[model samples]
Target: MIKIAVVGCGQIAQRWLRVLTAHPKVSVTALVDTDLAAARRLHALGQVDAVTATTVHQALALANVEAIVNLTPPAAEPEMTRLGLTLGLHVLAEKPLTVRAAPAQALIAHAEQVGRRLMVMRNRAFDPGYSAFVRSVAGRGPLLAAGETFVQLRAPGFRTAHTALADLGVHAIEQARRLTDAPVIAVRCTEHPAAHLAPHAGLVTLLLEFADETVVSWRGGYAGPGLRTPANGRWSADTATGSATFDGQRQLRVGDEMVELEPAAPGYELCIGDMLAVLTGGSITPASVSATDHATSISVLEAATLSLSTGDRIQLAGTR
Candidate 1:
């Protein structure tokens, strides 16, 4: 069995725990969090003989875990991943991997040199609801235009700078890239923090230009006025042949075929499952995570943030 440690006890950690505890070849050997109580709470529910520590260092010092599933926040991901790799542990990190692209790119190279598996959770690609959309886009010539919107209540931890763009916009960028054989090359963005209305960093409006001459407009934030659906998010894409729209509930309409998929495992569950399958000598048909692709997505968001400051379009330097 692959002994593993989960190094965060936040909203996402609980979801990962649900999937890990059920996997036969994986053992939940350690749980870590800055908040020991939260770690203890997770450990109590895991029903595994696990060590609970207040930090990754303490957990590694005490437990014989072979892998670490990093569920820490974006700001802490680079440091946590480096520490895990230094100890010769395979790492599966939750995305938006890090705030800065350079550190993230460096981590990818370091993991390759260390010969440890470093996988980012690019959950959208694993979702089945997008299958029809993928087919439709494949049949079409190329992606011409796209739009995606994300909104949620002002949750705790949304107050940090560019947190929303990094957290959710990463997914938007990934999904946008997924629609066609195109690379996003440039970005122009404008942010509306709307601080007087909320304590969090609010809405961000972005225009992404792609190598295939596709352009996608993106909007995402904690709490925003007048831009929301019955669902948490929604996306629409158009090509030469047909169009597609995903209603955030794992349902999509591709070229008039109204399709509502069954409640598939949440992307988080599927992503963690993929990571475990790889560890156990099983494989996902096409790998779900790529560090280079993630770097492009992160760099796009970085450009967006910089655009917020300078009020200009930012060009991405060679993502290939």
Candidate 2:
């Protein structure tokens, strides 16, 4: 059995631990968090035997861990990942791999050189609901019109300039890139003044043009009261035959058929499962890494920042 250690005892960590404990093929070896008490409490609930409520350095040294599932905030992500990679431990880090793109690239490069698996938690790709949406729309070929919105009406911890786009829009931007073969050639965003988060609450719209004459427009933001679907996030793909709406709960609607899928798998479990599968002589797939780079996501966010500052469209440098 693959031994996995979960670092960070936040809510996301709890979700991961819960799922990891339930998986029969994997063993939860250690629970590492800054707060030893919190980590122990969570482990008790999950029935995990080993627990380390200390710094990653201490936990890494103590646990006989094969992989570390990082669930820390954006600020601590880079450092933790760097240490884990240096130790030759396979790392499955939370997304927006780093706040900036350059550092993220360097980390990925190091991971590649060391022959260690460095997977980012871009779980939305594996989301059963989202996957259904991808399959429903991909058949249309070269998409014409597509829009994705990821807005956080309520704060779910960590509120920073990077969080709006990197944490949330990473999924949307990636989904857009996956749904449409075209890359985001240009982008524009707007932000409020410092009094109102300056450029915090803004909108980012991307214009993508493809070789097949296909065009895709994607808009994402965390401002205003967004989306009528209460806690409802859906990716609707429009085709000539009709449109399919993949509800957040793993239900799909294409044409006249509305199929209810089994409660889709949880994101963290899927991530850990994929990682373990690879260690046991299975090959890693591109699906995980295709959108793992948060640099493009950060760059697009940077453009949005500029647009908000100048009140004009900020064109990307390479989109031409």
Candidate 3:
């Protein structure tokens, strides 16, 4: 069994704990959080038998851990991942990898130097419905894609209008990248203020152009009330032959046919299972997003952020 330390004891961390504890190959050896009480509270739930610590260094001293499940916020991801790799532990981290592409690339290089796996969780890719949608569109030529995600969200204290694209739009951006067979060549974005929500929250619209001529338009926000969409949002793609659409739920429409998708295990469970398999010597598949892909996605987001500020289409230097 792989002994693992779970870093960050927030809501997402709790969800991951439930999945990790149930996995036969995993042993939850420690829980780490800045707030030791929060880590203790998670331990008190009785689902996991583990020690609690305020930092990864403390957790290492307290337990014999082989890997780290990094659940920290985006800003903390780079440091935590680097520390884990430096300490000779594999790291499975949450998304955005980092707000900038350079730092993410640097971390990937560090992980290589240490000969440890450094993976970012792309849970959405493992979702059965989204997976089906991707399979249905495979081999289709350069396409036109569009997606919209509108949900009423209570803005967290750490969120702001400027950060909305990185937080909510990354999924949609990555999804678009998955659907297309080309590199994202340019990105343009616009942000709008939402008066009804918290002062820091608002709406974002993004336009991505791919090297193969595929173009994707995506809009997402935390301010829409009745306009709320499912967590994955509504998505559609069109090629010369036909069009396909995903309601972001159990139904996928491909041309004249309807494919019913059955609900599967939570994405976190599936994602962790894949990671375990790879760690146990199984080969990696295209379905698993590589560190290179993660860096490319971060580059796209970084371009989008620049677009938001400059009001011009930002061109990527090259695809990572």
Error of 1 at 276 (Å): 0.8
lDDT per residue, candidate 1, 229-254, as tens digits?
A: 43325767788777878776767788
CA lDDT, every model vs. true structure: 0.75, 0.65, 0.83
Query: How many clashing pairs in candidate 3?
Result: 0
Tens digits of lDDT, candidate 2, 56-160: 667757777877888877888889888888888888777778755668778878888887878776666566566667777775766555555646444546565
Candidate 3, superposed: residue stretches over 4 Å from native: 155-157, 285-289, 318-320
Model 3 agreement with the true structure over 1-320: per-residue lDDT tens digits: 88999998887787788778877888999999999998988898846779999999889898999999998887887899999999999998888789888999999999889989888777765567787888888888888889998777664645665677888788877788888667888999998877656676578999999888888899987775677888878889999888999999899999999988887875657877787777766567335546768788888988998899899999986553
Better of 1 and 2 by TM-score: 1
In candidate 3 the C-alpha lDDT for residue 77 amounts to 79
Top candidate when judged by lDDT against the true structure = 3
Count of clashes, each model: 0, 3, 0
In order of appearance, the predictions have TM-scores of 0.90, 0.80, 0.94
Ranking by lDDT: 3, 1, 2
Task: Please give the lDDT score for candidate 3.
Answer: 0.83
